[model samples]
Target: MSGPADDEGSPPPAGYVPAEGRGGFSTLNGPYFHRPGEGELAEQAFFARRRHANGLGLVHGGMLSAFMDGVLAGAVFRGTGKTGVTIHLSIDFLHMARVGEWVMGEARLTRATRDVAFAEGRAYVGGHDVVRCSGIFKLMSRER
Candidate 1:
């Protein structure tokens, strides 16, 4: 069977647009994309380039963790209209995603209090699970 790396030049699935204003560490790691979903939800995607792969030719765990962090943080922002820093993050790796695959992630705000927000997210390639994560974020004012 042809592995994901064989489809290197394929375009991203429809309705995805380049995610803008992703500065700093994200800028170095991405050119990420997003598709707006039902209220306060968005799906994020990235094409796993060779830079994202580890020595074994699979997407690195650190890359998947960082992607999940962004996904959960985005859920917090959209669901609460506020921003926050990650206080705690937990991730589970289920399957390996190879380079050149289109990995997509979705997250939702599970609960939020004045001080903190909780969210869960998963990353996948096609129908296969890659990583699942949950996070706690310390809520912050937009003015900060």
Candidate 2:
């Protein structure tokens, strides 16, 4: 695992703040950050670390997939004010992201019904796209 010192001299892009209230797997995988955007949506980011890398020393596809999942879910929540469980998710791997790079992601809620929502998103490092994803979520009530 990486400590704070691993992030020395490298900072998230401007306008970002730590994303709070993340628990469970997210807690283990991240100290994620975000920048508020239009409506309730935000742009999400995380600095790649050694723990996020594959044996080849590139950021793992699984990590990027999980990040894209959060990005899409964030759109669902922000756009509809409802939380959800992913029913299906699809991802396309593009270029590579290495440790020490800042991986940024953005997503939009494409459509929704009473019980389901759809979203699309992408993760990038600088000008290069790392992954693209689309998701279907089953909306959960606020009472849950």
Candidate 3:
């Protein structure tokens, strides 16, 4: 978990807002609860075929990272109104995932306090975990 650290006051995201009335800090409620949009998250549909394999028919590794990134970012958006910076991320490929597979990613908050948050998530296919991620997000302040 290492990346270029951001100085204070970096913008989080367009709709970035603090997790209002959500305690001093917040955590993920599981995968299905943080749908910020229309079909993909709520409809429980698989959204990426472009990330699929080229030869042996497995999902690409970059695809794995992208999936993890999106899942964590979504969690950050839910836990805190604004978006969070992915300061640190570690992904472990547990197994191969193929195209046309319905998978879900969930962030399990290990800790969230102050301006930093620690969380973990697993990508599951058919109730089996295919990837695991541990992330450290730099929470940005929301203007009141």
CA-only RMSD, every prediction = 3.5, 2.4, 13.0
Q: Give per-residue CA lDDT, model 2, range 32-80, as digits (tens).
A: 8999766745489998888888988799999999888998999998888
Worst 10 residues of 3 by lDDT: 24-33
Report the Cα lDDT for candidate 3. 0.56
Q: Estimate each model's TM-score.
A: 0.90, 0.91, 0.62
- Residue 59 lDDT, candidate 1, scale 0-100: 92
TM-score winner between candidates 1 and 2: 2
Q: What TM-score, to 2 decimals, does candidate 3 have?
A: 0.62
The C-alpha lDDT values of all candidates are 0.87, 0.87, 0.56
- List where candidate 2 sits over 4 angstroms from the true fold: 1-9
The backbone clash count of each candidate, in order, is: 0, 0, 3
Sort all candidates by TM-score, best to worst. 2, 1, 3
The superposed Cα distance between candidate 3 and the true structure at residue 101, in angstroms, equals: 1.0
